[model samples]
Target: MGLFTDAYDLFCIPPIMRLIGRVYYGDVDDPKKRYQVPIAITSAMVAIALLGAVIGQLVFGHLGDRMGRRRVLAWCGNWRDYPLSATIMSEFANRRTRGGFIAAVFSMQGFGILASSTVTMAICAIFDAASHSSYEKTPKDADWAWRLILLIGSIPAGLTFYWRMKMPETARYTALVEHNVLQAVNDVRNVLDLPLRNEELPPYPSPLDYPFFSRAFFRRHGRDLFSSAISWFLVDVVFYSTTLVLSQLNDQYLPKKENMNAYQDAYNVARFQALLAICSTIPGYFATVLFIDHIGRVKIQIMGFFFMAIALFAMGIPYFSYWYDHSDRGFLFLYGFTFFFSNFGPNTTTFIVPAELFPARFRSTCHGISGAFGKIGAIVGSIGFYWASQQNEENDHSNAKRITAGLVILGGACIVGVIMTRLFTHETMGRSLDDNENDHVA
Candidate 1:
């Protein structure tokens, strides 16, 4: 539910922008006001939330390590969803199916996105029905609609807070960070519904031994940290930017909703986004859940990057000719494949790898850093794509070149991601969490 709310809040923003513009802002159709809407919406509504996310990830990550995953993961009551979920799942997961387990948890994001789209469409429908009027072209009467939708996001998050408080800390965290091996084993026994092993083990290492940012920490796991953060940053730059700019690309194929009322326009846009989620986005997540363990994170990510690059190139390069055709489905196939590969590929692997790659002492912290970096990429992509498009309009350059360049840049990002994976990232498939951590204990 935490990750679900995360995806819901992020995606719900785009469809409601028109409602916001018509109700809260003025004259978005004006050349003077045109650029203002996306920028203001992106900054105030979208970018600011993501910025908060970066800070939240870092702060909560640190605390999760210090206080315990269950104790600190209480954010939303304590942290963002990824690190906590990944950490708990990784620690608990069996070696053989760990990737699939983690990926399955992450897969809820697809349904979350689908929920966001469905809810957006339904809300618009309700408002249209209640008002007994098509949404006005320059809407002023329906200001309540957006506020209601935004508030609805809080409901699920609130419900999940109780469950989070009830959940137990992972055995790995209890044993390793807190240096309470007996308690750790007890926790594990309860979680797995198993009898405790009677075999004795060595004395617990002091928490002081694995101090973050110490010399030993750097030597043991610095490379993995760098790879996780940088690769995530690269993946998100393209992902966020492409998402924000996709409408422009789709605008070529989809006829502009001229003469339509605000509700009509919003509904169509909301419905379109929902279709994409249902048809491509959600399915891609399931693919990751199904195959990530078998293919290996490294291979899946590599394939995702290559295909994303090819699809972006196809979309961008053909923008002027074949891609822009009035009735062709070619661009959509390419576009949908990019979305597919992204979720099934880097998006899932990056999140999973960070949680699994590092020792428990630094696990959440490293994952937080990587997740934060991805947000940085998202901010860059969103602003950059918008600015590039605005520049194209102002300079009288063709829209095709604008799309082509933007997608090409994203493709280049995917290429960089592929290199990072090959050179830096260690595959996490079929390895026990204990095995992964031992590499950092030297």
Candidate 2:
């Protein structure tokens, strides 16, 4: 649910940005500047949440490790719950199902994206009906539409707060990190609803208490940490760049500016986003859930990155001139595949691997560290791409060419992801958390 809220809040902004522009920056005298929100303002509005996320991930991640996952999770706000969710899922799930479990939790992001688009579309439709005036003629109606969409994001966050508080501390954290054998056994017994056995339980393994920055810890997990962080960073660069720029892409596919009013423009953009999520994003997440365990994280991530690169390059390279001159449908098809492979590949795997590869004591912290890097990538992608897109427009570059440049850069990032995944990551499939944690000890 937290992940759901995260996606909703983050994604709902793009469609409404034009509405925001119409409300504040609309210029009736100049057609080109009419609905254009300044690039600086647009970038700031989109990147602010992601900037906050980087800080929140680091702070909450460390808190989850030091204080306890359940306590930290309950105390932290919903938007920063990614690392905590990954850690808790990793600790609780069995080895055979761990990848799917964690991936399943993250998959809520797809629904969140879908919901944001759907809700925005509904709100725009409602306002369009109520105002009985085109937004271009009376921009005030757009004000209400964007606000209602943003407010709806808070609902899921509020609904999940109590459940977060009620969640039990993971047994792995209690047993391995806290070294509380009896409490851990009881936690497992209660969760499983199993009869308590009279037989003695095995002694808990001695804690590997290396500090996160210590040489011992670095030697054990340095490669995995670097792998996870860098992989996440690269994927997010492409993921967010493509996502936040969809409005610009939609503009190309949409009918001519003279043909539609502002309300119709906003509605169509939201509708297109919803369609993309339904056709590509949601299916990709579920595909990961189905295949992640069978395929292994490393293989899936490498495959995802590789294909994402292929799809992106197809849209950007040899076909760039063709796309610029030709069918929007052909371009959108390849574009959709990038989202598909991202979910089925590195995006899901990066989140899962960090949670599993680290020791119980440092799991949340490492995941947090990794997630922070991803957010940094998001910030770069959102702000950087918007700036680039604006620059292209200023230079009289066609929207197609601007989008092509961004796609090519994103493709390069995916290629780098492939290399990094191949070099730095390890397969965690069917391996116990304890086995992964202790494998680097010697």
Candidate 1 lDDT by residue in tens digits, 189-253: 77778787835433444444657868887787888899999888988888887776686456545
- Candidate no. 1 TM-score: 0.93
lDDT string for model 2 (83-164, tens) is 8999999988999998999999999999998899899888877777777655354446677778888899988888788888
TM-score leader: 2
The best candidate in terms of lDDT? 2
Instruction: Indicate the worst ten consecutive residues by lDDT in candidate 2.
Output: 196-205
Question: Residue 149 in candidate 1 has what lDDT?
Answer: 77
Q: Over 4 Å off in model 1, which ranges? A: 25-41, 77-79, 138-141, 197-210, 252-255, 325-327, 392-396
| lDDT score, candidate 1 | 0.77
Q: In model 1, what lDDT does residue 150 have? A: 77
Off by over 4 Å in 2: 134-136, 198-202, 392-394, 398-403, 440-442
Cα RMSD of all models vs. native, in order, equals 2.5, 1.9
